[model samples]
Target: MAHRMTPPSRLLASVGLAAALAFGATACGDTSSDGPNGAADITIVTGFYPAQFLADSLLGDSGTNVDVVNLTPPGAEPHHLELTPDDVIRLAEADLVITLDGFQHAVDEAIEEARPAAVIDLAPAADLTTKAGSDGLDYHFWLDTTRYGRVASTLAERLTELIPAEADAIAANLATLLTTLDAVDTAYRDGLAACEQELIVTGHTAFGYLAQRYGLVERGIAGLEPEDEPSANALADLATLVNDNGVTTIFFETLTSPDIAKTLAAETGANTNVLDPIEGVSNDSRGGDYVAIMNSNLEALRAGLRCG
Candidate 1:
């Protein structure tokens, strides 16, 4: 069984928000008529699209006051983006701040110092995430549907607690969201189950959790981060695996350059295609909702893996 890590509530008091209901207060606001901002809420900060999209789906149109803003601009790599002094100010007053840790060291520091009302640190294993190379825990947890479900439940419970009056609405929304995600999860299982191959070759090790959940092998051309290149031995092993297993597709991520995946595919006589790590959305994608993105992922896996 995978061990689940829960955030320590007391750790959030540094940001001047009550730890008991920080998520509801910061992200959804307090629903009490006497509560500051009268509970019809807004969201000010988020590190990526998946969490924000989940939050909006949970909050729904009834919570129109809720706003989701991407702290990292479109096409910007989260690991390397620097938050300016102005960005700090914007986050300070934010109701909710969702972020992946370590990669955005600057943002992590700001959160530790600023302590926005409710902060959702997406990197459960922040201590394990590394810039050293691709061999560490990748912070892209939403790529795995199972982990995404856990995260969504935590978000929903917190949002429900914060806005008790809207609990029914939030629960309804969350149920719908979970149902949609479950369908996608089922699709991945059913589709990948009949694949001609079980190995997933990719540019970065972003699909580690996905592979784990689905019982497939993930071979990356580079490390956890896109910028890191594979060792010559790693390349040789990948080539051997492709030839031996008859792996067809070399999957490159949407967020980074695919020069390496393409080259590997060329050398191995395998086809190359795009698989979304979904750190952020590009202009070409319709929008970065978790369902849409994951559906796209399903299609890619079907085509790339020759799913039956």
Candidate 2:
């Protein structure tokens, strides 16, 4: 019998407390206020790095004074990230906060308490009950470029509203953003359109929408939670899938343990490689950002999926 797993809240709390101690405390404060002469200080607390990247891009380098920070540590489960007391203070004082619903449970709690002036819940406010596009309750929306565009648009609008003077610039910025995203979409479409392999087997099920958009089948070792290990039956089934589909590559995420993937690759005699879901960048991410990570994933997919 498969054992039922606990949700990530407990896990996040445990990790968060430890990380808070290790990293000590760092709070992002905006000294410049909404005074007559100064621009409002903007600090965005994101659940992950991709969200932070999008925030930075939308806020722009000039006109908008924004500081973006990731709440999840490197190799941590995003769904389980809990906010420290310091994190709560950051959320309470921020001019605006963006959340991808269940992605940051701890941050959500703080938001409820703080009730900031502007809160953009990326969960569509309309469908909190339904699971995110795919993989069942997976909150990693940034991986899906299509859904990501919607969230990016919302972020752009919210940032514009927060800093009304930058509205025109924000519009232009969003236009540029849309164009870039379109290019990404085209890249995937063209790259994977006529692939010999239609199935993408990965460590975590983060590419639900990406696979859907490119018309590829996604088979994951674990469910939504990256830390969750598959059952014995699940592994056996996955092995069968690999053999049947003639799968030559097994993808693993950068932020999770690759042991299972390594074992599978050895058993199936398939090649193994890192296919980043871009959850969050560790301090040692080598200054990698959103575009760099996603573009890397695109290239890896093309090579691994044998889509030449």
Candidate 3:
């Protein structure tokens, strides 16, 4: 089990919107709705793409009236996000915020001080049981579509409680979202049912939850955090595992460098392919949205792992 961390719901008074207006967070809403200029003027700040995706889905059409802000920009690593003064002010002024406290240190600090109107920490809903890199909790729960679906239900229930007027719409959207997730789960289950290799080597340990759910083993060149560089001995051991286990493909991430993975693949005489963490979407990402990207990943896994 990962070291249990608490996500606070400290709902404090707003710190006035003037600070955010003054600072002008240029890189706001990378995966969000319109700015805080909607009809309801309700601001919802999501820490990154995973939570942002759920908010976008559950809000249904009411997203037009709600201002959804995502703090992390496209193509950036969510684990090491740095917030500016305006970002903190945005946190303070937001009507509701969805964040996983332990994942991003800077955002966690900002949330403590900014104290938005309502903060829903996703750790409780995510059920992060998988441990990685020295027994730390793997925060990439959304990669497993089933776990992501469960989190969606939790978010929908809480959102309906907060905004009762949109309850009906949220319910309708929840049905649709759940159906999609169910289908994705089925696809992954079937697609990876019979593969030549069950081990997935990657740039980092972000896929622990996903791998655990799908009954595949995961090895990373780096540790849990993307920046955790591996020792030379570790790399040599992973290369030997690749050769011994017949693991043909070395998976790299979209946000991080491919050098380490590629070098290992060359040493082991294996191939390299992309295995996106779906942390932040970008033009270079495999697909535009969650479902599409997941399907893209399935195809890559089947090809690389020699799935039957």
- Candidate 1, residues 45-73, lDDT tens digits: the string is 77667777777788885544665666777
**TM-score for each of the candidates:** 0.79, 0.81, 0.88
Task: Choose 1 or 2, whichever is better by TM-score.
Answer: 2
- Against the correct fold, how does model 1 do in TM-score? 0.79
Q: Residue 214, candidate 3: how far off, in angstroms?
A: 1.7
Q: List residue ranges in candidate 1 displaced over 4 A.
A: 1-41, 123-135, 286-288
**Cα lDDT of model 2 by residue, 1-308, tens digit:** 11123234532545543354234234323333233444346666666667777787776745755666666766675767877665654555566777877666678776665555567887882233323445457566677776778878878878877788888887887788878888888888888876788888998887776776788888888787776789989898999999999999999877778899998999899998778788777653423776667788888888887887
What overall lDDT goes with each candidate model?
0.71, 0.71, 0.82
* Pairs of colliding residues, candidate 2: 12-80
What is the C-alpha lDDT profile of model 3 across 1-308, one tens digit per residue? 01112233332323333344335555444333444342245668877898998898888587447767789988898898988666776677677889997999887877777666799888888888757446788888899888898899999988887788899899999999999999999999999999988999988888888788889989988888899999999999998999999988999999989999999999999999999889889999999988899999999989988999
Error of 2 at 146 (Å): 2.3
TM-score, cand. 2 vs. native: 0.81
Better of 2 and 3 by lDDT: 3
> Could you give me the TM-score of model 3 versus the true structure?
0.88
Question: What local lDDT does model 1 show for residue 131?
Answer: 24
Prediction RMSDs, each to the true structure: 8.8, 8.8, 6.4
lDDT for residue 67 in candidate 3, whole number 0-100: 65
